[model samples]
Target: MGASKVIHAIYTDDDVLMSAVKKIKAEKHHIEEVFTPFPVHGLDKAMGLAPTRLAITAFIYGTIGLIVSIVMMNFIMIEDWPQDIGGKPSFSFIENMPAFVPIMFELTIFFAAHLMVITFYLRSRIWPFKDAENPDPRTTDDHFLMEIPIYNNNQLELENLLKETGAVEINIVEKDEAH
Candidate 1:
C-alpha cells in the first residue's frame, strides 16, 4: 500500500487540544495519537481510550511477594532452624507472626513498585537505548500535538475543523506504511 497521510495539529494550550480532540471525535475522525509535555487530566477518557489494568497487576504482584515472604520466614524460623529467644521458642509461625509483618509489608511494596514499573515499560514497548517515537520535539517542552489519520479524502474538512478548534499550526505529513 501507499503511504498514509496524517494531520498534525499543534496547540499551545491543553484546553484547546482537548476541545479539538472532542470536536474531531464528534466528527468521527480517528485520532492516531496525542503528544503532550505533561499529563493532562481526563485526556484519556476524552480520547475514548479504555481504563488501564496496571492496578490489577500491581495487586497480584504484591500478593505474590507477601506469600514469598511468609514461606521464607516460615522455613527459616520454624522448620529449618528454630531459635529460642527471651524464653520463647520459635517453633510456630503463628506465634511469631508479629515480627514478620514488617518484612512482609516491605517485600510487598518492593515487588509492587518494581514490577509495576517493569510491566508499564514492557507494555508501552519502551526499552533502554531505544529511539524516541515522538513526532514533534516541541511536545516534550510545552506544546501539545494531536495526530489524526486522513481517510476518504477528508483532509480539507479535517484541516478546517482543526483551525476552528484553535490549532496554532496544522501540518500534513506522509506517514510511512511500514509502521
Candidate 2:
C-alpha cells in the first residue's frame, strides 16, 4: 500500500500563518491542524471553525451541581440530621437556606470545573499518559506549523504555494496510517 504523505508549512509569524490559512482554504485544501506557540486571535475564524458548545455543557454541569447540593443539603440537614444551623431555631431547610449559600456556590463551581475537564478530554480523544502526536517540536516554541494532506502528486505545487504565503520552512513527509 502507498504510504500517506503530508506537507508541513512552518511560519515564524502568526500574521503569515493566518494569511496562509486563508489561501489554503481558498484553494479548497483540507487543513489538519495549525500549531501555535500561543493564542492567535481570530485564527479560528480564519480557519472557518464552528463555534464551540462547551459553554452549554458547562451550564448543564452547573445546573446539575446546584440540584445535587440542594437535595443533599435538604436531606442531610433537615431529614437525616436536623441541626441548629446558623443558630437558627427553625430546622427547616427552606428557612436555613441562607446558611447553605456558600456550600451551594462551591459545589456549583466544583462540578462545572470537573465535568468540563472530563468533557474536554473525551471530546479531544485525549487521556492521561497518552503519547504526544505533535509532528514537530518547534511548533511548541517559536514556530507555527500548518499541516496539509498530500493527495495524488501535489507536493511541489503545495510547497510553492506555502512559500508564497511566507512560510519559512516547507517539508513533505510520509505519514503512517497506523501508529
Q: TM-score per candidate, in order?
A: 0.96, 0.92
Judge candidate 2 against the unseen true structure and give its global Cα lDDT, from 0 to 1: 0.89
Stretches off by above 4 angstroms in model 2 are 1-3
> What's the CA RMSD of model 1 in angstroms?
1.4
Name the candidate that leads on TM-score.
Answer: 1
What are the lDDT scores of the predictions, listed in order? 0.93, 0.89
Q: Cα miss at 132, model 1 (Å)?
A: 0.1
**Candidate 1 lDDT over residue span 11-124, tens digit each:** 999988898889889988889999999999989999999999999999999999999899999999999999998888998999999988999999999999999999999999
Model 2 TM? 0.92
**Pairs of colliding residues, candidate 2:** none
* Model 1 regions more than 4 Å off: 1-3
Q: After the best TM-score superposition of candidate 2, give how far the Cα of residue 171 lies from its true spot, in angstroms.
A: 0.8
Clashes of each: 0, 0
What is candidate 2's lDDT per residue for 1-179, written digit by digit as tens?
A: 44399898899999889999999999888787899989999889988899999999999999999999999998988899786645775468778888899999999999999999999999987998998888899988999999888888888888888888999998888887874
